[model samples]
Target: MNTIGSWQNHAISLGLPPNTPVKKQIDEFIRRWDNFR
Candidate 1:
């Protein structure tokens, strides 16, 4: 998948809205990256 597609997946998996702002998405991902790590 493309980068945007992957970003959407990440947001969805985190229970975030697909339309979430990019900065919020990044913060959420960073906060929960241990799930992947």
Candidate 2:
């Protein structure tokens, strides 16, 4: 899955809205994953 999709999944797993400001947390997670890659 793409970053945005994976982010959405992370947010959903956390019971957050897909577009919630907390989605920033998901974006951070994606950033970390990208950095690791």
Candidate 3:
């Protein structure tokens, strides 16, 4: 998704790898937040 890509880009700008576990955690967090909303 474009939003996911944009988030990954932001993470990369902060020096994290796109495929890192931190990225996966953030993705999961967003998914849960969206579901809760």
Q: Highest TM-score, which number?
A: 1
Q: Model-by-model lDDT, in order?
A: 0.74, 0.66, 0.64
Q: Model 3 over residues 1-37: C-alpha lDDT tens digits?
A: 2455666665665456765566575776687679999
Q: Total backbone clashes of model 2?
A: 0
State the weakest 10-residue window (summed lDDT) of model 1.
1-10
1 against 2, candidate with superior TM-score: 1
- Which ten residues in a row are the worst by lDDT in model 3? 1-10
Judged by whole-model lDDT over C-alpha atoms, candidate 1 comes out at: 0.74
Considering every candidate listed, which one attains the maximal lDDT? 1
Model 1: residues >4 Å from true position, as ranges?
Answer: 1-9, 34-37
- TM-score of structure candidate 2: 0.41
**lDDT of model 2 at position 30:** 78
Report the error of model 3 at residue 37, Å: 0.4
TM-scores of the candidates are: 0.53, 0.41, 0.46
**Model 2 per-residue lDDT tens digits across residues 1-33:** 345566556677656677656557757667878
Clashing pairs in 1: none
Order the candidates by TM-score, highest first.
Answer: 1, 3, 2
